[model samples]
Target: MLHKTELEYDANNHLFLDAYHDDAQPYLGLLIDIHGGGWFRGDKDKDADWATRLAQLGYEVLVPNYRLTPQVFYPEPLRDMDTLMTWIATSDFNQMPIGVVGSSAGGNMAVELAIRYGVPAVSLSGILDIDDWLTQHQAVEAAPGDLDRFNQQSSAAINQTGSNDAFYKWFVLNYFNQRTDELSAATPVHRISATTGPLFLANSLAEFVPTSGVLKLADALTSVQVPFVLNVLPGNRHAKGYLDDIFSQITAFLATYLIDQRPKPQLATE
Candidate 1:
């Protein structure tokens, strides 16, 4: 009963998004699932399965393709997200409650959008604090066999001597074009304010993305009094790797804010 439609969002850039939903059911809300590939690679199709699953749950899911690094730099991808939001606001689904879920780089953007629009969001292994992440990597020495293990598991080709943390740092630098000064502005942990919406953040205790950043963001959200849930799993899995195990919790969190909290129509007292 699931249906999917691909629609263009940015014609000039030839960017498009896939919409997934069940035609037989009323949409509970709109959930945007952003794909993640360290901000340098990845496409909307990467999240098709996740979108379909969400759609089956009675939510209209949107998976968008945004510009990546090398072709574009900091804020360009975020700008594309802005365009998508604008498009949604004018579309037929404008009035529906909105929530976002993303992995890694996409998770970072989800938090950004949540901060911008005050909508509920979930970030899975998001690189929340770029500056702190780089600093931490620089401060610590890689453990024995860490580099080899990372290279063995990574899909992207990495030098034999490179650790997972180093590879992550390379991509982050690439996304920012090495403008270290600008990293703070793009760091979601630093951007949190009182207006930021509820967020469910998850990260593995020993994942390549590092748990330190997630903890920092959690502390920052606390300081601002923004409601959030931090789930730190046990393993080296990053982002989508541990998603299946925690998916139910993710959906429950979304439903709490987007569906359960929504105002219900009053019944007539005839």
Candidate 2:
């Protein structure tokens, strides 16, 4: 069964959450699905398909939307997420094994949630470092009106092999609220430490968010000996395209922590 309702995760943010659960199968866990529109666009409906699929896999899927950028800013969205989780803790979903599946910007939030709260998470073609992303785009002479195209060229950058797609660049720029210096804090790669939780990150070689950021995250996790899996696929697709073939693999990984609640794999020191 699926239902639509408004849940106020924060006093200032009321999320439109589309929830799905299968009655035939016992509920395994709560999986929050976040959509990717680069923090400025997107809504619950965008991720409804993925959410319902996860629900069919026996987990309750909740796809929620938060405040967007230029209007709300970076930390505001993160704060809204914090409120969402806090509300969940006090509601019917309290303490149930929780996980997150996010695409792009949503992936960034999901990873932050996992790092902050110690929950398991998976990111599909997410941007790990916005600063690095901006730098890459600038190197290609991309600007505010470039759309998904790298330069002022008529062709979309995403259509070209090895080129990146960053349609949300303007949104991200506004998310910083004109204070670009704050981006360092918003960049997940910079924040990742030894305490970060189990993560499954998959990226397509031909997409926007550079594979370099993913590699950097993997390296940091490895340095701390954190248990994680980084999958770099050979393709020129973005978020949803990268997800089509990896659905089963992701569900299995979610099952490891959400259903089985496996003990955290110890690092060499731990």
Candidate 3:
């Protein structure tokens, strides 16, 4: 069974949740699905197909709609996500451990949330570094408004005092929240502590954003002694088979971590 409901967020942000059930036994607490649109466009509706599949597996899923770029910049989405998670924690569906799933831009944000909140997360070809992305976008030499309508926050930060790397003067600012250190802090690898939960990150070697981002995150996780799993499929799309693989692992992971369906003690031999 699947049900849809609206969730409230800071400043009248209306997020939606798609509830799923199968066999009645709770296999998960709550699942959050974030849509990717380069931080500029995209909606929860696009994630419906994936959410629906997860719901059929008996997990409650929330697909949040956030204010896109040109209207709001970095940190806003993070705040929006925080508000949604807090609401879920206090809501009736707050029974099971929360597992967040994200792809592309959303994947990047998902890693940040999991790290910041100490929740389990699965990132599909997540974009970990905004600086790197902007470099690829060629926003540095391009005219303003090429990347974002707002002031180039990232570019300005990197070259505040007019340091070299002329191209660095036009970095992607919306995602980094105008803070370089925040990038380091928000990164899943940086957030990894002994308390950090398990993570499953998959990327395609052919995809620059997801592939390089996953590599960076994996390296950081190694340095911090955090438990994480990385899967790189050569010649694959960013979100290729994402719904299938993510849902499968999430189901089993939830069963192992949340349900605790241990066997009952057997009666003494008669």
Error of 2 at 126 (Å): 0.7
Q: For residues 185-213, could you state the per-residue lDDT of candidate 2 as single tens digits?
A: 77887777777878999888876666877
Superposition TM-score, candidate 2 onto the true structure: 0.85
TM-scores for every predicted model: 0.88, 0.85, 0.73
lDDT of each: 0.82, 0.74, 0.62
> What is candidate 2's local distance difference test score?
0.74
Stretches of candidate 2 exceeding 4 Å from the true structure: 1-6, 133-140, 144-162, 165-171, 260-270
| Per-residue lDDT over 1-270 for candidate 1, one digit per residue giving the tens place of the 0 to 100 score | 888999998888899999999988888899999888778777888788778889999999999999998899998999999999999999987989999999888899999999999989999888787877776667554332233322122222322222366567777888888778887788887778998889999987766677777798789989999888999987677777777888999988998989744769999998
The best candidate in terms of TM-score: 1
**Ten-residue region with minimum lDDT total, candidate 2:** 149-158
Cα deviation at 215, candidate 3, in Å, is 1.6
Each prediction's RMSD to truth? 4.3, 5.9, 8.0
Looking at model 3, report the run of 10 residues with the lowest lDDT sum. 150-159
Winner by TM-score between candidate 3 and candidate 2: 2
Order of candidates by lDDT, top first? 1, 2, 3
